[model samples]
Target: MKKQNQKAWFFVLPVLLLVAFNALIPMMTVVNYSVQETFGNNLFFWEGLGWFEKLLRSERFHAALGRQFMFTGMILAIEVPLGVIIALSMPRSGFWVPVCLVLMALPMLIPWNVVGAMWNIFTLPDIGLLGYLMNHVLGIDYNMTQDPFAAWATIIVMDVWHWTSLVVLLSYAGLVSIPEAYYQAARIDGASNWSVFRHIQLPKMKQVLTIAILLRFMDSFNIYTEPFVLTGGGPGNATTLLSIDLVKIALGQFDLGPAAAMSLIYFVITLFVSWLFYTLMTKDDE
Candidate 1:
């Protein structure tokens, strides 16, 4: 047993080294930059806690953080249940299973920028199917460029379309992996559909649901490209998430110190929340 456990470490060692080189080194550099002020030509001055303090008090940061949380919460709430329902409705044993899975996976395979650009063209009010139907047929002002609510709605809908497939796939995997014996036993006991699902399917799916929730939360919280390409963080600052605002500060405004500090804070918050989610999701098992 000891030798087998020791052999497993060899498989993990390469990955650990790669992560250290690629992720940890860059992260430490960012931490260093976050604490120092730099002038042009490689001049740096100690400015410990200054940038962090400023970001903590900044109204823009507060607003962006609030919007980020709201978007992530809304996404998880909507996607999780919807994905589960879709998964449950899908055929359990059929030749169509592979076809359905491939179709579901298609969206997630597209490049992020392409997804954004495609949506941009597809939502044009003149030629776009959705835009024309919503604005003209429904008699609603649905232009994302001019209206804040419209912009928000478009972004949310686009995100749901893009990412709900991930949850669906994961849930479907969990559902399919459940042994037929469990269903047989449930049937023998005269279990109703709801009871079987509640007692067996839902519990078995907890791990995958936890993965879906964490992935969606982190992705939504850190979302930038789609919204940036779609709205450029605005028709005003209505869609400026924390990640977008951080990029704006770092590149657009050349505020490296503050942006670095904010990035560190962003990383910390994500890590903390993810750990909490893992704990909560796994606690019942113990």
Candidate 2:
């Protein structure tokens, strides 16, 4: 048997060290703050688990977390199916293939903050295009700044517009990689379009779909900038997701200890749910 080469380890060591330096240092700092209270001037008092206990009992935390779950769930429900459908409709070959791909990728290429700013301007009631059309032309009472439902709808639609492209691109990649033989066999068997999709295309796309679900789940769960810029967590706390709430506690209220504790809890919940998603999605492979 040939010996394993060890030289490649040296090449990767610097990157590993850099990652650890960045991640571990901040994590350790958070851990310290989580268990301690600060009264400024770098003075910290031992608080033990007080902050965590307080956070678990806070109604604000519960509401924010609930909103976060709602947002993520809605995002997944809308984007996943919509993306798959768009991907299936895309041209599989020739000149239109590149054109379709470039269009699909355009939304994702825009900066996150810019997307939020663009939507904010685009939805202004009197002057914005969508708002003017909805309120004036279509005669709909639509104002995100004054209405909770409108705010939520605007954010959800904004997110779908911004991110469904990711799911579409991933799904399209999976679709394109499927062997042409599968389609030919389905045709020979007189498979209906629905039957072809359900039986062959869906099964073949499982791996990429798993990836899409996980990525969307994590991103939506942790989303901050767009909603913050678009709604500022709403006309009220109607759209305040967990990340926004955490930032409010940390910076808005200057509550370092509770913020740190909440961050740790948020981190744990994300990890646990992600693990659950991975396990359920891949269980059949085992």
Candidate 3:
């Protein structure tokens, strides 16, 4: 039997310490707060799992979670297919490839809050470009501030604009990684474009697609800053996602115990859904 080198653990010690300080410590603190009620000057009282029970039965929590899921679902439905199509349409090898990649990357490079702020201004009915196009140039009633549907649509479009590039870039990478031999074989067999894509490209892209879906799911589910800045969960709670609700509980209402409980529940839901996505995507292989 070969003896594994224990010295490698020393090399990883710094990362472990960093994780403990950043993640583990905060998580432990939240766990403590979840079970304990707090008052002024760091005073605390035992609350047990009462907060958790309260949140579990809260209508507000249920509504926020439903909205979050709907937003994420719409994002996935729109962004994934749109991204794959964009990637597929892109040149496989050419001077335009880098330019396309750069353009796709531009939205993602913008700061999250900045993206929100930019959209907020850009959707102003009087002066903004999109708002002008919709309201004046197209003769449409496009007020996100007043209409719940409009507000939801605006946030969805804003998120898709901001993050679809991630899926495009990932799918593009998967597309470009295909060997020339596969194409040659397909050509030799007189395979149709759809056939080639269905048989060759689809399988090749599955791994990356899985990654894209998981990433988008997690990020969209946990999203806060952008939507908050853009809509403030507004048009009468039309876009108030679970994260925003969590923030309201934690900071707005100063209900630390319930907030902490809600945080843990949110964390678990995200983890569970992400795991389910990964498992279902990969199950076919095994």
Candidate 4:
């Protein structure tokens, strides 16, 4: 029998330690906070799962969660298909390949907070480009700050603009990675475009699309910075996502116990749903 090298762990030790220090430690802190009540002077008392129970029953929590799911669902529905379409439209190989990729990548390159701020300014009623185009040029009463529908539409559109490129890039990678022989064979078999895509391209892209879906789901689900900056959970709680609500409880109301519980719950929901997605996507493979 060949002996495995035990020395490989030495190279990976630092990374493990780093993860523990950064992720594990903070997680432990959150876990601690979730079960305890804290006042001032770093004092804490045992509260058990009271906060969790309270939040579970709270109508406010339910509304925030529902809104969050709705937003996430909307973006996923829009970004995935739109991304695939855009990716399919892109040149397979040419001088425009790099140019197209660069353009697609521009939105993602901007920081999240900056993206939110940019969109907020871009959609402002008075001096903003989009707002001006809609109100003045198009003669539409499109004010996101005051209109709930407008606010929702703006956030959804902003997210789609920012993140759909990610899906496009991933899908393109999957598409380009497919063996040229597959296309040639499909052509020889007199395969239709729809048939070629349905069988050859889609099956090949499954892994990447699965990855894309998982990434988009998690990111959209946990999203805070952009929408918070763009909407501030307002037009009066019209778009208060789960993360925003958690922040409000933790920071605004100084309700540490409830906030901590909500965060843990939030974490579990994200983990479970991501796991569920992965499992469902990969089940046939297994």
Per-residue lDDT of 1-286 in model 3, one digit per residue for the tens?
9999999999999999999999999999999999999998999999999999999999999999999999999999999999999999999888999999999999999999999999999999999999999999999999899999999999999999999999999999999999989999999999999999999999999999999999999999999999999889998888899999999989999999999999999999999999999999999998
Which ten residues in a row are the worst by lDDT in model 3? Answer: 230-239
- As a TM-score, model 3 comes out at 0.95
lDDT of 2 by residue, 185-205 (tens): 999999999999999999989
Q: Estimated TM-score per prediction?
A: 0.92, 0.95, 0.95, 0.95
Worst 10 residues of 4 by lDDT: 124-133
Q: Candidate 1 at residue 265, lDDT?
A: 97
Estimate the lDDT of model 4: 0.96
Higher-lDDT candidate of 1 and 2: 2
**Model 2, residue 284: what's the lDDT?**
93
The lDDT for every candidate, in the order shown, is 0.90, 0.96, 0.95, 0.96
**Candidates 3 and 4: which is better by TM-score?**
3
Candidate 4 residues lying further than 4 Å off, grouped into runs, are 1-16
The clash count for each model shown is 0, 0, 0, 0
Clashing pairs for model 1 are: none
